[model samples]
Target: MKWIRARLADGNDEKGSACAPGAFHALLEDDRVLPVRGDPYNGHERTGEILRLDDVRLDVPVVPPTFYCVGLNYTKHIATEGLKIPDKPDVGYRANNALIAHGEDVIMPADATKVHYEGELVVVIGKRARSLSPDEARGCVLGYTMGNDVSERNWQKSDRTFWRAKNTDTFKPMGPWIDTDVDIENMETVVKVNGRESTRFHTNDMLFGIDTFISTMSRYLTLYPGDILWMGTDGHSPDLADGDVVEVSLTGLGTLRNRFVRER
Candidate 1:
């Protein structure tokens, strides 16, 4: 099932009846969505009223309780940067404030340069998991979505912790929607800059795949439903500039496109 968070496009009033109070609704054919009523951390439903997708403005599909990311997990990304592969996963956290929905503009910091896009597959957790084995890890996944791990390269190198480099407002563009039935192991990722293909890689090419990362993370802390993990990106990306449009596409998951505009 495909899921989305949307509100009627009449205005910015998010209290519209198209979706539940705080949960994502399942998308249906005929441009409609099944309203989900209940806590998303557990399970939800399509029991409520149906609304047209075109009539509502799609928001970020999910706002994860804990946004985690694994860097340098893709072999090509490491090799391209001439970085040594780590024996263990290099996991990190991303601020929720960085997230933006599809059709949103990524406001590039006026003082920044060397902003790059890292097209990646995002895993959304469905069930609570702790100390799970590789076999059990995959079961915890709720669905998959597309994301751009936008980064300011200069700040990444100079800052002690990746604050401004990775956590700028509107930096992370994830959506279109989430697909619950995607084949995570064999998906293809394609990235476009200004409508031109810039990077392409198979989802399974990561040096450390989902099973490993999920299993590893579970050993440290409990992962609840609605938690999300960004599975990193492959290959290199050209620096983004004002007016540049970036789109990240996963084979089964839809494309997430955002335009970059310099902050005034």
Candidate 2:
């Protein structure tokens, strides 16, 4: 089942209502995200009214407890650039403040150029996990979603840490909804810019899959519910500019489309 966090277009602004801030979980049904009344973190009980998909605005699916990401996880993605393959998965942290929902604008700082897009499959943790084995990792996942890891290449090359390069506000575009049922090994990622295809690769082409990252990270720190793990991207993207529309399509996962605008 596909799940979303949204507010009703015309509901009351009161907390816990359909109009409240990222108010509640909604199940997708025939062009609508019907609000699931109960605690989505625990159960899928229907609590209140249903909202049509067009009648509600999408929000970052969940307020993640921690936002984790991996880089160069895809073999083809790394090999394409002739980059060295790492012996182990390289993990990174992204700012939740940078996250934007589908249809939001990704700001391109006027002084910065060489901005790029990395279309990735994102993992949403459903249960608390610690020191999990690779086999146990799958059970902890609630669902999968899509993400666009927007980067500023120049800043990336100069900064020791990817602060401004990767954590710039509006850098991460994820959502539309999370799919509870997907074959991780069979998903494909396709990226487009201004209607032109820029990148495409299989989701499972990763040098290290979800199991590796979860197990590895869990060994050092606890992974909590609502934590998001971006599985990284494959292929390359041309430098993005103002007025560009980027669409990241991950097979069964809905497309996450966002426009780019120069920060004036």
Q: What are the lDDT figures for the candidates, one per model?
A: 0.85, 0.85
Estimate the lDDT of model 2: 0.85
Candidate 1 has a TM-score of 0.93
lDDT of 1 by residue, 1-264 (tens): 787876566653455454544335566554776766654456666666766776677788888899998888888798887888989886899989999999999999888889999998999999989999999888999888888989998999899998899999998888988788988767899999999999988887888889999999999899988899999889999988899999898887878999999999
Q: Candidate 1, residue 44: CA error in Å? A: 2.6
RMSD over all Cα atoms, model 2: 2.2
Segments in model 2 whose C-alpha atoms lie over 4 Å from true places: 10-22, 79-82
lDDT per residue for candidate 2 within 1-264, as digits (tens), equals: 888887655554543554336467788876866777564577766755765687777887877989999988877767865778899876888998899999889998887888999999999999988999998988899998999999998998889998889989999889989999988778889899998998888888888888989988888989888999999888888989889999999889979999999999
Residues forming the 10-long window of minimal summed lDDT in candidate 2? 11-20
> How badly does each model clash, as a count of residue pairs?
0, 1
